[model samples]
Target chain A: MNEYLENAKAQMRKGVLEYCILSVLSEGDAYVSDIIRRLKEAQMIVVEGTLYPLLMRQKNAGWLAYRWEESTQGPPRKYYAITDAGRQLLAELDTAWQDLGDSVIKIRQPEKTHSHEKRI
Target chain B: MKNVFNICINGIIFGIEEDAFKPLSDYLEPLKAYFSREKDGSEIVADIEARIAELFTERPGGAATAITIADVNAIISTLGTPAAIAGVDESANTEAQPCAPRRTARRLFRNPAERYISGVCGGIATWFGMSPAILRIALIVATFFIHWLPILYLVLWAVIPLAKTTAQKLEMYGKEVNITNIEQSVKDNSLDTGSPVQTFFRDVDSALGRFCRILLRIVVLVIGLKLIVAGLMLLVAFIVWTCLQDVLFRDVVKWDFLAYEEMLRHIISASSYQIFMICSVVFILLTVAACLFWGAQLIRPFKTGNRMTHILLAALWAGSAMGIVGISLREMRHFTNPNSMSETFTVPVTDTLHLQTVSANMKLSNNAVTGLYFDKSQQRFFGEPTLNICHSRNGQALLEIRRRALGRSKPDAFDKLAGIGYQVAINDTLLQLPDLFSVSPPDRWSFQEVHLFLYLPENTIVAMDEGVMAHMHSNAHSRTGQQEYLWRVTDKGPRKIK
Candidate 1:
């Protein structure tokens, strides 16, 4: 049961981590702060450190884009949002997620032959 | 408005505002317009946004309270494209978009952090993906202990800005697009309400404060380190000195205890005693000097501390050393002069004339022995001698003072009065003084060679003896010399007063 639970959590992570990040940005052209707060609220376990490195990796992989804005307090601020590539990849991930979910549900489902045996 | 949707994305739950939802639905209309033939664009946009709001509100911290555009994106992502959701794969349709820097999207980051003075050192190290060690070591070594380094840190802390706005700090990490922290992106790090002059003054004030703190910290650290090193060295020095105590002080005093006393006895002298006494005093003086030097080590780097405290400690050390020397000198005296009374030099040759001379008429300071006594008169074959003298034990020689006439007419009553009149007084013997009193030259009859004929008993002990040969030679010599000065000893011996 523990092994099955572990696999379930792993499958959830691969499908959800990127969607979760993009979901935060769909609010607006949000900065890193907005994303972390949203993720932290959802118990996403995303840290500022972990998030930035991942963001940088994704940006390199062409799933992200950014722009600069002048700020009064410090030097300048950068805001980020998903591009078409991010949207497309998120779509592909959604289908893959449904398929994985069905497969896992079928495995955990009670056997049809055992259903009649239990009813007696 | 009949349907209210709550969106929870990544567990962040917030309600989808109808006003915010309307704009997002309007923006996705263009994308849905491409699939208009296959799916109802308005219906698809509405259904996706409702699901997005539901998920936003489903998040843990009431994400339903405020809905951002990012919420709509998550729902769209879940549903896929209009073509994909309407039962068509998006394999070929999504290919035309190439990832590029977004000119339309604004980036948010933490202000160039200045809240922490040296945080620049820390922040830059973090931002550039560099280790703090490399920066810190290079700075310290390069600055040669810069007096202004701390000030620089303070100024940096006050002026550069802080990462209070989540957007600015993220900018330091160079991430802008797809940032989820829009609400945290509020508030520009620069003071929004203050005037230009006020901001300038604030910067200057913080800069000065930072400078002072850095300087003070460095100075305190340096001084503390110096004190610690000096204390360690002094501890080692003290240990070494204590170990060498026996060797250092063993031979400081040098005198044959018995020989000194024997010389003083037979010669009726105090010169040897003085020499021995001085040796002991010198020994004590050296020990005190050594101890003082050792004590100074207790307060190593004493020169750097408070002047008044240094002076006070120095005075205390000096006083203690002085006391030690004084006590030691006093104790040393006992080794030279001990107490015992038996061997007295008994004067017996009463029928014959016996005279003595003290080489140096040093004062007979020892009070143990009193004046010398001789009662019976001697029948001198020559002219009757007038003055009687003796040497005292404390080194001073004395003579019985007498009245005399310089000249007189032949055997007259006036001569009798001037010469021997009623001036003579009597005691157990003539009242005597130290032998130095007879340094006067006789007018015509010169003193001849000394005859050592005085018989003193063997068992007798005397502190001064000048009754025989020494007495005669000194008298003859005095009678012959230029009368300006007196008793001059030819050998290694003591001399006397004029």
Candidate 2:
């Protein structure tokens, strides 16, 4: 039962990871390291390695684009930016997130009333 | 000190320790494989490499510091495993997945870790999924039947590269070049969670390895037994040959009356001969002892002696070998200077002159010794002389006797030549020569030899006896082992008169 809960939690995280990457890129043009830092700060991804393939998949679908930039510390970095398609996808995901939040609140309202009655 | 390699990752050069490099690369291999299924797989890998480079640069020592295994493990945890990076639950995969791609093509590389000599056999055993000990034993047995096997082994040693890197080691065993296997190989174990088929093959490989190891142990035991037997036999032979020379080899060899040391005393000087005898005895004893000890140790490994005992035995063997070499070099000075003395006697010219060989009136004994003969009656040693017939430079018939000996100097050689005695008698038309020359005592056997040259005038006829055939050294005539032959001395050489 615990294993199923852990697996379901992972699935839920994975489903929203792409939407989070596009949202992070919508802010500004960022390199892989910068993007990974933002996603990790928000607890959207566990490993930095997981973000590369998601970003690649997004770029392949014309939702994101990247450019090579020289770095002072090491090799050249690939800077990623949200394309017009990516912005459109992010706007649609924002509305969908809002609708899901509203539905959860409405469903909890009845449960809260029943729990309160049981307490009385 | 750990070996350090300079590697370029994502166009950024970094120095990494050998132990660290294996795990680091192992972590990257599966990531590369997993990402390769995507459209921009290479780009993703390159980006990952770039991030790793950045992480390395951000360390305390920066890029100047060599990466350690701890650093690599830290980086791996941060990046996560290939399954984790792919967002797949590692726990679930472990329960369901096979350990690695089964039986990839194995490459030939010398295994440096588990090696006895240069890792050739160890590498071959690993390649074939067997035990190294078995391969080593088979090679040793093969060396006896195929003499050039050592040369081929040397060639292979030079040709095969050592599996120095983790990926190379994985390739050597035909393990898939992936993160999990690399990690497992580095840790020196198989994955705890593998499918039933992978588990079955692993069990079989280990079982075969165990079987080969047992066979190798048995072969070593048998070899130890053989060596003990051989060493004991050699010891007994040496004792019999040295102590009971007269009883064991009396009829076989003429020197059987003299003991081993006594025979040496006849040839070498008194003072040096003693040293030679001591060195030779020590050498023989040490050799036999070493053989026995080695055999015993192989039969029961590390059961008898410690490192100190081995060191002492090695030192004694080396010392005895050096002593033998020194004594031999000292004895070789006697043969440095060789001198010869020749005498010519004019013979009566006749149409036909008879040439004959006279024996010493002693029974010819069939002896195994060569070059030197012992005269029991006179208590002296005699050596055979050579006889040759040639045309005379002048018109006179002449007979020349040349005696040669080796000594310390010219005069010493001439003094030793006085010990060599060869008698020749000219009776009008008949010439008689002694078959052997005597070397009396105080001069020793110093390669003493005599040569008789019978020079005849042109058209002079000479008749040779059958007894002289043994001493004949003439290439002009075809020796058919005939009883007697007549030859006429011509300008060119002696021509057979039939």
Candidate 3:
């Protein structure tokens, strides 16, 4: 049961990881480290290395664009920003998220189902 | 202390401990392979490397301190496994089982970490899954029977590549190439926990390595100490020899009457002699400095200014050596063409001709110096001339004085030969020849030599003095301690008339 829960949690995180990254960049441009930091703060991702492929995949799909920014401490930083298509997709994802949350909440309310049956 | 290697990652350089590099490289290699199927995969790897570089730079000591294995482990944990990085659902912990030993074909590679010499025997042992000690012993035992085994081992040592990387090390033991195996091999510090004999050999190998390292250090220290002592002694000896040339050469040693400078001046031109002395002194000083520097380095290793100092020293040494060689070549020209001048003095026709040698009779403690001597009153260098006897064709008695010397040219040789001084006093039938001949100053030595040839009629009886025995040629042999010996000049040359 614990393995099943872990699998489900991993699957859920993997599904929404791209959405969370886009949402973070939709607010403003951020380099990879900053994005990783914010995502880690939100508990959206565990490892920083996991974010690179997702970012690359999103950029290849035209939802994210990146630019090289000079870094003071090390090599140049790759700053990612959401594109117009990414913003449009985030709006659609926002509605989908709300609808899914409502469905889940409605499915969770057994008391409402019992009260409806009592009224019947 | 662990060895540190300078590694460049994403254009930033860092010093990393030798053991830490294996894990770090193993983590990246699998990640690279996992991502290679995607477009811009190399770009993703580059980004990850850049991040790693940034993380390394962000450490407390920055890039100045060596990156240890703990630092590498922390980075690896932060980066997660390659599968997780590739968005795979599988957890790293679930897949952490040790790789099963597979019977794959193994490639031969020199196992440098477990080697006694070039790791050939260890490599062969690993190939056949046996203890390296067995193979090493076998090779040693076989070497006595087959002399060519060592040559073959050297050939194999040159041909085989070292198992430097984790993958090659795994391949050497025929382990399957997978993420688990690579990680295991990297983290496996205690490698090859095999049979008891193998473990024993492994323990012995490490112990021997430690022993050899200590022995090498002790050897270096001993050599350094010896060099320091030898260099200091040589320096002191050089100084003493240079400063007290007269006391060392004349009084205390009585080896040579001429001083060091005087002896050098006799062999080379005055200008070249000065240059030679300067060059010799500089060379000795530079050599001593080099010896001291290297000795100190060996005893207590420390960094100096830069490679420039070493280069400067080597340059000075080579320059001095070249100067010495150039002066020697220039001086060699003086002793090239040899010329001889002969002077003949006719002797009275007599059946009995007395020959005697007049000793220089200089006041001395003892006759320690041979062949060459110094005349105190004349202040000249004199050498003993050789005496030879032969029959004359004219049936007349004659004494011939042949002075030979070398110079740059034939005329120069003749001019140098003119410097040779020899005198023979003829009184009635007795000829008194000085045992020593003198070479005048300003001409240098140039291999000056003198030979006296006594030409006499057949059956002429000749008597030689005891002092002339040392100067006699090998053709004329006489027993020592004898006052005199009679020699008859016959048609068949001089025969000793006992």
Candidate 4:
């Protein structure tokens, strides 16, 4: 039963990772390390590898952008932010996520729509 | 060793190490490539990256942290696959400009490069959302390893590219496609030259640099060739000395003990040529030593700058070598002498008269044995020559031996025998043999009344040989210090001092 819930959560997490990353980028320029921290706190995505490839994929797709900002520690690091395309995708992903949660509940328990506080 | 693995993402290469970055980079590349292909998937990848970055910020800065592959796989699963993103984008892209610039989030800059290869160039391009080719080429040209520029170019070419996934693309131009390139490049934008003299010197400096490089290359080539030659010579000398040296020693002291003077005589005679041999040995040693010095010079130390120490060291090295050679000719001559003179000589058979030509040639024909005296009283091969002897392949007709003996022949003896008194006779003769021969007289003979009689092996023509006389005179005059002792009749000649 726990495995089943975890599997669903994992799938949901995948679809929503873009939204989560964009959310952090949406706040301000964040280094890879910092972004990882924020995502972990939100329990959005726990793996670190997914981020680099995902960042590359989005950069390729022209949804997110970056600039090189010199740091005092060493050479410059690439700071990231959400593009307009990124913002649009995040909105769609956010709505979809909410719909996904609501639809799952509506399907599993058709007669219970009274309140939002429901325990798994 | 924390072996750094070069990780290439979006066609850019980065030397990524620390277990954390390695797996992170490995996991990111393929996923990024997949996301870039799906239109809406770019957003998916970007979101996932942002989330990952958020996680990184959450970690306490420490060496023990390691990013595992499971962490990557889990995040990848959450980000959804390319096929799903494509399906969603396809269904959503019905209206005009349906892939609208999402206005939901805003940020100051784009962290476009994720575990990307040397982001120096890629970062510059992504900073302005420009194509990376020009930047990459510029970086390549400026790289200090200009000879290996092609290799580096290919690596960067393969590792870094325009952002591939939605996340990377957003990151690249993600900084609202800023006009960041106007000032942020590593290359200087303005050239300020106010002084003509400065410009002139700069030109001179560059020209001088070219000249020096050309000259240095030629010098290095010549030195390298010389070094090889010297090395080969050293090897040959050492091998010959090591292998044949035994034969030389054996042939001299053991096999044919009598030919010691004929061949080995030059080696161990009382006035043996150990000095010359010592000089030669030193020369060979210096050859090897010099070669090694040059061999060590070939290594390059610094990464970017010229090796100044190489030049100075080479100069001092060569100078010191010459100095060492100068000193060695005079001093280190005692080391490799092959000559072994008997501790003492007998005088009965080596009578005072025949001792001068013991190691000298006599005007005698083959099939004639010269008479040599050995003194049982003195126990030395003093005057004449040793009787029992062995000759080389060309058999000996006359034995030239070096023995110290007193003067037995009076100066008037040759006058009485030749019927010529106080008159020197000079007849030049050329004797055929290998190597040079020397003459020595007994310590007791009086030079003024000395007369030499060649009891040469009978049957040969005897002549007043000028070559022998001149050589003997030179030998006598050049003595270390005069004992003033009368020399025996020189086997060299019947040259009476005029």
Candidate 5:
């Protein structure tokens, strides 16, 4: 029973990985390690392997561009930056997420209509 | 001691223990399999590899060190299995439909734990739900008829990644890679649940592997040592030859160059031959040393100045080859338009003629004695003309002395050929000839040598000393005896005189 639930949770997390990556990159160009740190801070991504495929797909689709930057330690790192296409897609996703959040809030807390909770 | 394998990941070099490399490879293989059908699969894999390399860098003093199983396992857990990530693609492919939970595909991994000789047959047997013994028997039988089967098996063993983890062991048997299967496989393998025959074969396999490794190491060491010794000898010989080329070829080495002293002088003056010799020797020595070093590296691989040395040696070799070819082309000009000059002398029609060599103690200069010594050494480097006995055209005994040489043109060849000095003294019935012919320096070697033809009339009898046999052509069947013997010319040919 626990296995099924854990599997479901992982599946749910996999769906949102691409959106989260795009969102992280939307703020500014970031090194892969920096992006990984941001994702870990949000507790949205676990293994770094899972995000690689998503980042590669985004880059291949011309939604992202990357450049090599010299690192203080070790070799140079590849920094990925969001392209215009990526920003356009992020805007659409943001609108859809807002609508979905509103609908879910209305359905779950019908009694407290129009009430907003401050969450961290 | 644990052996470490050097690997390049994302263009960065890393050393990892042999035991840990298997599990790490196993962890990466599934990720590759998951993205294989994707449009940007290889790029995704490359990114993943880079990320792994980055993670290794973050490890405590682990940047260039050997990565252990613990490190690999931690990374694998953090990355999550490919099965965990399959949902997104599956859901997208199904067109917004609820994604069905898919069973993880079973992977064929070589079972090293129970392996006898690479464990390929064992892993395959487990995959097919068959006994490993049966597969081993079948393979052995097939190997007898199909000569290449053993080689193919070795190639497969090398290519297939071994199943080191419980998850991998479960996958090897086509079992689900869930927790229960992993737990069961671990328990089953740890506890001796396998048959006695399997255990025996496993032990034998491991023992054989150790033996093979030791044997291979000895073979490589012996071959490496031999190469080093051979290379050192070649280098020493080259040094000695270079230092003593002139002395060795001139005095110590009694080589008769047909006594063309002028030709020898010309050859020595030309610097190209010397350059050709030195360059060739250097090239050969360096190549030998390179081969020895390569053998040593093969025996025990380690980082060295491999590329720079290779380039340097290759360039030197090429330069030497060009020098040899260019110098040889120039040398070839000295050997054209071969010509011969003949001088005929009349002799009295004696009933019996005796041909003999001058005594070793006869009146001769010091140079002549050394020339005789060189001839006696049997190290003649130039061609000597044949002495022929033929019937005279004018029914008289005539001695024809001919000297042959090669030069740039007809006049030059004739002049060089005429320069060859030889003397023949006729005393009564005896004709005496010098054993060693002389040639002076300032002239390049021109294959100069004299040919003596004793033109005897129909009834004239001839006797030749044993020394004359050295100059006689092989086809001239001169009847030779313990002492000088006479031969009478008959209708058939020269017949031994009673």
Candidate 6:
């Protein structure tokens, strides 16, 4: 039962992880480790394995592109950048996420109906 | 260690242990399988492997000589397990245990508030749920047994973080760092203020502690540097001396139990000499290595094997010493009996009997032989026969030549002494002697010596050539002059001829 809740939470977070990755890449290009570090700093991702497939899928869908950058310390790193399609996708996901957040807040906190009514 | 396999991941090459390579390869297989459905799956796996290689290079030690199974396991932990990478738990992999919930493990943190020598023991005791006093007693006992235990403790004290914050102190003792605990700790600290006297003593104690620590560090640095230099010079000297002995005197020095190698071999076991040499060499090497190790450790602490290593080294050193002593005693047995060989020749008493040396051309063998030179004259080697003029026992004028050697028995020593080849020719008044004594090739060089005793009558005179004066016996009263002086023996001992 606990495992099911964890899987459900993981799935919920997985959806927005893509939106977050696109939003980060929209600003500038980043190495794969740099992206993982940024996501970790925000407490949005758990493992590095989750990012590779997501980045590959985004690239396959023509929303992201990556190039190899040589590193002085060790192996060359894969740097990812957002294509125009990824920016468009990020814009659409931002609006949808804000709407879902507001609806969830309204449903969960019925005592805030007065504030909700005033805002509407 | 087992042989390592050379592997190339991406463009970099690494030598990995045979056992670690299998698990690491197996781990990558699953990663490949997980990404197989994607178009660029192999590329992703390659990139990950390259990253794994990079991380492996950054392990505590610089390069992986033989990557152990532990190294592979550590890499897996850092990169996540195969099951986590695949996101699908396969029942086939028994190692796919779910990652445990990340709980704060009690970290070792020195508590300055309760410190006695960095509070490392206190921190360790708290972490292990033991009383600090018991741990301190145990550590003291271990330090006595293990010579480097104190240094190891100091290194840990330098490395482990201090528990400065309340949360860290709570973690050190495995206490829950919640709001209640924090509030209670704050309240306790505010209420329990030490007396002014206690506070003053504490401040003085910490100040003294800091001063001692700095002083110890400076002393260690200076002494360590000095010892390191001394150790290096000793090592170099040892190397040079050993090399010279091994190379330069390989055939010259008869490495036998006694003087004559062949004779000793026939009399006693030859292996004892070899054992003695080996034992001495091992003892020297172990002592030198210990010195170098200690000096290096003082300069910079390193993780060395525990007490067992020291015990084993000490045992080996003792064993070598015993081996040397046993073999040396065995060798000394060959010299128990002494013997001498003497030849006497009658000579007519003259006013003066001059002692002169034969030319060097006659002394040098057709084949070149190298040995220690006894004087400025390169022609005379240490084993070369020495001529010492002494008074003969009888009142009659005569010359006696005695050669000496040692052996296990009387006859053996006499036979060995007889092998010394020394010759003197009487030409008119001049006694011509070979510049160097020759020991037969078959005879071993036992401290063999040649003594030439020329007996003089009460009124007879004697003179020595400058060439043989260097080999004169201490009692021979030969006066030194620009031209060698002759000495006349009257009733009142020998007097210089004016």
Docking class of 4: incorrect
lDDT ranking of the models? 3, 2, 5, 6, 4, 1
Is 1 or 3 the stronger prediction by TM-score?
Answer: 3
Model 1, runs deviating above 4 Å: A1-15, A111-120, B1-498
Which 10 successive residues of model 5 chain B have the least lDDT summed?
A: B364-373
Provide TM-scores for the models.
Answer: 0.19, 0.49, 0.58, 0.25, 0.50, 0.38
Report the lDDT tens digits of candidate 4 across residue range B1-498.
565555433332344445646446544444454444456545555555545543333335421344344544554465443333332333234234444543323222222342223444544554554444455446545776567766865675565554433334433444221112111111131111111224554464456557756878777767767776778788786876646655666544432222212222222333434543454455566567657556445433234335786566556556555654664453333222322112222122222222111133333211112222223233223222212222122222333332222122443222222221121222223222211221232211111121222233222332223333323423434333433233323344333233
- Count clashing residue pairs per candidate: 83, 0, 0, 117, 13, 2
Q: After superposition, how far is residue B58 of candidate 5 from its true place, in Å?
A: 10
Provide the RMSD of all predictions against the true structure, rounded to 1 decimal: 30.4, 15.0, 11.2, 23.9, 10.7, 21.8
What DockQ does each listed candidate score? Answer: 0.01, 0.40, 0.47, 0.04, 0.34, 0.17
TM-score ranking, best first: 3, 5, 2, 6, 4, 1
Per-residue lDDT tens digits for candidate 1, residues B385-481, read 2221233343322232333222223233223223221221222222222232211121111121111221222222222233322333244333333
TM-score of chain B of 4: 0.23
TM-score of predicted structure 4: 0.25
Clashing pairs in 2: none
Model 4 Cα lDDT, one tens digit per residue, A1-120: 998797577666777777788888888877766787899888776545456656766777877998877766334567787899988887888798899888998888765664444533
Q: Over the stretch B243-276, how does candidate 5's per-residue lDDT look in tens digits?
A: 6555565666444323323233245345765686
Interface RMSD of 1: 15.4
- Model 3 agreement with the true structure over B1-498: per-residue lDDT tens digits: 889999999998999999998878878876765455457978999999998988898889899999999999888788777756764523443446434455568988888755778888888888888888767768878999999999999999999998765566777878755555654544554344422355677776667668868989999999889888878988887887788655655666644445555566768887898889888888989988888888888898988878888899889888988999999998899888999888998899997888788887774222243355665455567777898888898887778888889999999998888888888899998889897876876335667889988888998888877777667785555567788878888888888876
Give the CA lDDT, 0 to 100, for residue B181 in model 4: 19
State the interface C-alpha RMSD of candidate 5: 2.3
Best by TM-score: 3
* Candidate 3 backbone collisions, by pair: none
**Which is the better candidate, 5 or 6, if ranked by lDDT?**
5
